[model samples]
Each structure stands twice: as structure tokens, then as C-alpha cells.
Target: MMVQIENKIILVTGGAGFIGSNLCEYLLSQRNKVICLDNFATGKTSNIQHLLSNPNFTLIVGDIRNLSDCHKAVSGVDYILHEAALGSVPRSINDPITSNDVNVSGFLNMLVAARDAKVKKFIYAASSSTYGDSEALPKVENTIGKPLSPYAITKYVNELYADIFFHTYGLNTIGLRYFNVFGRKQDPNGAYAAVIPKFVMQLMKYESPIINGDGNYSRDFTYIDNVIQMNVLAMLTENPEAMNTVYNTAFGDRTTLNNLMEYLKKHMSQYDEKIASVEVIHGPNRAGDIPHSLASIEKAKKLLNYNPEFSMKDGLKEAVDWYWNNLK
Candidate 1:
């Protein structure tokens, strides 16, 4: 059975973004009070529009980059799921300064606030990109490689800060290194949009989806539902060993980009057969991108009892259905 985190005031930073908004909605459904702090720079208002009506859901228009804003959001909160960060490797590559400001500086600000607020636990979103330049397959929690981009460096810095907060200030923290997460409400219109959502949007319109390389890059494409489950587990787990460590939040499988496109087309073809005929275009590989990513969920499974219920194919089908109905 899934552990329940109920009746507590939970803060979700970047709560207007894709994953953060979903976490807010779920927490509210479980009878918990949810405080969402967002600046809406990249987060869309449309994402959390429905939840605005709920009294249990409080929206704070704030930026994490500001220390005062972090303090305000952390006030009277029992726990925090810090999802606010500047994602996208290319964006960080183009402008490293802004990324560092929001990701590294903002993360430190949150850690300080969480410590001061005496929050029970601090669970923040880490990234698989921290495994940059590592040729190892089935990435383990302890092993990592040198960061390849500013974004990766920032995310790695988050884990470091979380660890120090735990040791120096006696804060309980967990960092979830999320792989290629996708599903409903993931914005498909952005220069830095994730591959799955971007491709799904294009295929729905019968537009040719461009592959960055020869289309063999594989990823452990995790479903949003699975990610949600992991977050909740990270929050509620009573195991002391589980505390003050990071876990790879993934579906424990890999799918090549070519296979991913084929899966998307197969799922979408159910609505429009012509989607199968849409040709895929190839382009140069993206900078700061690794060729393959897979995760070893054994650590998470044993420590947190994380049993991901969706394979890449299953998640892809669900995502296709959502985009077809909503984005179309």
C-alpha cells in the first residue's frame, strides 16, 4: 500500500510548473494543505488554474531567487518539496549566470529557510543530468560523473547543499534525481521543452518531429504518476537510513529515441491513422546531452519501497492519450 502524507501543510516551490503543479493537486486531494510558491517565469498560470478555487490550496506569487520569498513560503510549513529550478541543459549552456542564480543560489536560500522553519523534511528535485559524461549504464545513487553543463552543476550543488544542511543544522532531507519525466500538463511549446512532450505535440499536429541525433539516444522515460509516488515516499518514509541521501527516481528501464517515436506514433495513431505517416527529421546532437541514461532502482526499492507501476511504453501511451484529448 502507498504511504499517506496527510493533514500537514506542504510547500511546493515552482508549484506552477509541470511536476510541481501535479504534486500540489495530489497533496490537496489527500486532505493536506498545499502552499504553492511560483514566479511564473517558466510556469504557466493555466497549469494550476483549477486548484485556485480550493481553500486548502494557497498560491504565493514569489521567486525562490529571493531569500525573503523563500522564507515567506517556508513559514508555518511542515514539509517542503522544492521543485523550483531552471531546467534544460541548452538553456543553461546559453546563459549560465541566470541558471546558477536561480538553481544554486535559490536552492541555498530554500535550505536555509527550511532549516529555520523547522520543517519535518525537505525533499527537493535532483536530476539525472548529474550523471553527465559517465559511460556507465544503470546509474546508481552513489556513483556520478563530472557535470557537463551549468544546469547539471547547479543540480549537483543542490544535493551537496541538502547534505550539508542535514549534517550542519540537523535537517532531514532527500533528493530525488528524476530522469526524463513526462505526462499530462507538461508544456509542449517551448525551446527547452522535454523530448517526449515536444515530440507528442508535433506528432499530434502531424508535424515532423525532429530527432536531435541519429535517434538512438536512450532514456529511462519515467511516468508522472511514478514520480508522484516517489515524492510521497520520500516525504513519509520513517527509515533513518533513507534520510539524508539521494535516490534515482525512474521506471528502471530505457527506451531509444527511435523506439520512443515509434511508441508515440503507435499510441496516437489510434486517434488519427495519418500520424503514423509523419516523417521524422534528424538534426545535430544537442550540446550537454548524454547518449544514454538508465537507472538502478534497487536502492530506492529497498530503502523507500518504491515500486514504479509504469514502464516507458505504458507511460508513453498514457501521455499520448492526455495530449490527444487536451492539447489537440
Candidate 2:
């Protein structure tokens, strides 16, 4: 049975962010009324500025750290997609306390608010970083290792509290462990910028992009469209085996940094011929970095009927086009 999400009042926390804004746009396109809560901490208003005219979209500028703000945002909402968090391992390493305050404490505030509101289901953006130091090829939900950073610890804690909420308070929740998601609307001008967007931006300017490792580290570079699909499926799924469980939301493939650089250089050269000659410099491996990551999405497949529609190559082409047209 296919789940139809129509006319539902959904609260999308951090909807001004890269993933959150994309999710809000998708939900609005589906005829759902979306309330976007964001503090502009890491999220930018430009991401959601275009959606301001949509009648189905409501924007609330507020911090998640405040319980009253979360309480107000979750009110009268049918579902909660908690996407507000301080991401990036280096950022967390630079300031562990602030990261914990936002990712851990702020997460609890949202959970409490959603539970009180009696929202149908709560979905959050978990991370593949939770599989830190495991050395596992294809990471499964139940199998994990010791967290390598403060950011990893914060995300794993989200899963812990979510499970306790289900068992102790009977609040239904789902977590999607995302692996290296990238695409349109992703910010490339930040100190904690992700690899794909940053690299693309650097290449567009004909600048050398730095590879953080020996160019051998690999990741499941998921596209944002696929992430949107996973979120929608997690929220709408009615399968008895699906609720209260975490799923790995990835394309079930991996790409090394070196190969990814070559792919990006080839793709970007189509727009600017000079990009073909861009050099990539290798640097020391980053702290709290994983060597390789791949996801076994079988659980998401069987339980939520999640069918990822875009590969890295296909998604990157579309993303690069968007960046070329918009980010200039």
C-alpha cells in the first residue's frame, strides 16, 4: 500500500538548511502544509526565500535550543522531521560543548515538544558517522562502533533517546542514517562545507581543491533527492516492521575521493573548459575521519519500500548545472 501525504501539517525543523529546505519544498509540492523552524545557525534564509510565496509554507525563525521555541513550533503539527543540528566533525571538534548543546540537548527539546504535541511520527537526520571506527564495509543499522568524534556521539545519542521514547513513552520515531548527502542548495561558502559542493565551487573558479586524505578514503555519496525520498517514505510508511527503527539511507555504492575528484573535474569541464586543467592537492587525513563507508540499504528496501532513484553521476550532473546557473 502506498502512503499518501496530503493536507498534513508537517513541522520541518531547520527547514532553512540544505536538506531541510529541500525536504520542505518536496512536502509542499505534495500538497502538505509545512511549518519551517530555523535559527539560521548553520541554515541560510536564501535556501527558503523562494518558498516564502507558497501558501502551504510557513516560516518561523527561531532557535532549537529554546524549549519554548520548539514547543511553539511543534504545536498543531501532524508530524515532525527534526533536521536541526550542528553537523561536521571538525566543527564539533573545534567546539564540542556547543555541538552537544545543539545536537544533543536541542534534540531532546524537539522530542519532548513532539511527544507533548502527540505528533503521528518523528523522523530525524541521523548520520553514517555513527558507524565510526567500525571498519565495516556495508554498515547495517544494529551494528555500530565507538564514536570517533563529538558529532558522532551526538547523533548516536539521538537514536538512544528515540528508542527510549518509543519504549517508555510510546512515542513513535524513525532515524535515517544519511551518508555524505550532496546536491542543490547545499552551501559551499562555509568553513565546514561538504566535499561535493566545495569541490564543485573550487573547480568552477579554476582553483585547486584539497583532498583531505591520501585520496583513498571512500564514501557513499548520496544525492539530496534520494534523501528526500527516504524522509517521505519514513514518515508515510505504515509497515509494522518499519516504525521505531533506524534505516541506512544511501545508494548502496561507494566512491573514493580520487575517483570522485576525477568525476567532478570531467563533469565541470563541460561548463568551463579551463576546469579540465585544475589540479587537486592531497593533504593529511582529517581528524575523526573514516577510511571508507558503504551502506547495506536492504532494511530500508524491505521495510520502507525505499527505492533510490539517482546515482552519484546522475545526481552530480544535475547539481553541477544548478550550481553553475544559480551559485554564480
Candidate 3:
């Protein structure tokens, strides 16, 4: 049995972020009352600005690191889609303490508040980085390697804490181990920007986009709509076995950086022919970077009936159109 996800109150943490904002928008469209809690550290106000006038939307400008904020956000919430955290492995490496504070400690704060509020479920954005140093091809839920970076460590810790919360406190939690997610509203301007949007923007300007490695590194590259679908499925699923477990939220396929560049250039050329001429530069491999990352999404499929609607190629085309129309 699946719980209907309409006309309920949902709290989306980091609601102004790329993934969070999209979740907020989707839940609102479903007639669910939405409370957006964000510190705007990495999240942008513009992302949720359009929803500000909606009667069902409420914005709480707060940090997850603050327990009071978490408590306040959960006061009347039915479910929580926790997307608040400092992303990017390099940023975490540069400031491990701050990352730990936000990703780990702040996560604890939200869990405590959710447990106290007795929300239906606590669904959070876990990461592919948790696979870490393992040379695994298709990462399964139970098997994992030692974390390779500070960011990886924090995300893995979140899974551990979520499991503990379920067992100890009777708090139902679902952790979605997201692969390389990308799509609309994904910011292209940032030192830590995701590769797809960043590359699209760079190519749009006829500037050469740099690949961090030999251009052979690959990722599952799940789309935002697919991610949103997984989140909704996580919320609606009444399967007892599905609750209190982690699932890989991905499209279950991988694309190399070189192939990704070709896809982007091919799509962008429709708007401007010059985009195709833009060269892609290959540089040395990035630190704490995995060579190839893929997901075995069988768990999510069998348990939640999660069917991803977008392939990497299909999503890239959609995302490129969005960036071209909005950013250009």
C-alpha cells in the first residue's frame, strides 16, 4: 500500500538549494503545505522566490546547525525531506570542521526534532561518495567501502545515525544514496558547481570546459525529476521493509565525462553553432575522486517501485534547454 502524498504538510530542509528547491516546488504542486527551512549558505533565495507568494508555502530562514530552527520547522510538519548539508568533497576537505558541524551535527539536530515531532518519515539526501575507496562497479546498499573524503565520511555517518534513530528512538527514516544528480535550477556559477551545468554554461559562452581527469571518469548522473520521484516514493511507500533502510536514488546507468561533453555540445549547438566548436580540456585527476561510479538500484525498484523517468542523455537535453532559456 502507498500513502497518498497530497494535501499534507511537508518540511523541506535546505529548500532553497538545487535539489531542495525542486523538492519544495514539487510538494507544493501536489497541494501539500510546504515549509522551506534554509540558511542560504549554499542555497539561493531566487530558487524559492517564485513560491513565496503561494499560500501553502512558508519560508523559514534558519540554519540546520541550530536545534531551535529544526524544532521550529517541524512544529506542524507531516514529513521531512532533509536536503540540508554542505556538498562537495573539496569544500569538506578544505573545511572539515564546518562540514562535520553542518552535515553530521546538524543532521543529528534534525533527527532529534523529527523524533520529537513524530513526523511520518525522515528522508535525506545521502551520497554516492559513501562508496569511497572500494573498486565496486555497481554499488549495492549494504556493501560499502571506507570513506575517501571528509564529505564521504559525513554522509556515511548520516546513514549510520539514521539506522540508529530507527532502532533506538523508533523514528522511521529513509536515506537516498543519490548519485551525480543534475537538472534544472542547478547553479552553473560556483567554485564547487556540478559538472553538467558548469560544462553547459562554459560551452554556452564558447569557453573550454575543463575535465578534472582523463575524461574517462564516469557517473550515474541521475536527473532531478528522477530524484523527486524517489523522494515521493520514499514518502508514500507503506512497505515495512522499505522503511528504515537506504536505497540508491539513481537512473542505474553511467556516462563518461567525454560522452557527457559530447551530449552537451550536441544539444547546445541547436541554439548556437559555436557551442560545438568549444574545446574540452582534460586535466589531472581531482583528489578524492572516484574513477567510475554506478548504482544497483534493484533495492529501490523492488521495494518502492521506483522507476526513473530520465536517462542521462534525455536529462542532459532537458537540462541544457533549461539553462539556455533561463541563463542565456
> Tens digit of lDDT per residue, candidate 3, span 1-328?
2224799999999999999999989888888999999999999999999999999999999999999999999997889999999999999989999999999999999999999999999999999999998887899998899898999999999999999999999999999999999999999998899999999888988899999988999999999999999999999988899999999999999999999998888888989998888988888999999899999999999999988889999998889989988999
Cα lDDT tens digits for candidate 1, 54-128: 999999999998999999999999899999988999999999999999999999999999999999999999999
lDDT of 2 by residue, 1-328 (tens): 2235788999999999999999998899889999999999989889998899999899998988999999999999989999999999999999999999999999999999988999999999999999989987789899999999999999999999999999988889999999999999999988999999999989988889999978999999999999988998888887767999899999999999999999998988887889999988999999999999999999999999888989989888889999999987
Candidate 1 global TM-score: 0.99
Which stretches of candidate 2 lie above 4 Å from their native place? 1-4
TM-score of each: 0.99, 0.98, 0.98
lDDT of 2 at 226: 92
Candidate 3 segments whose C-alpha is farther than 4 A from its true place: 1-4
CA-lDDT, candidates in order? 0.93, 0.92, 0.93
Cα lDDT, model 3, residue 62: 97
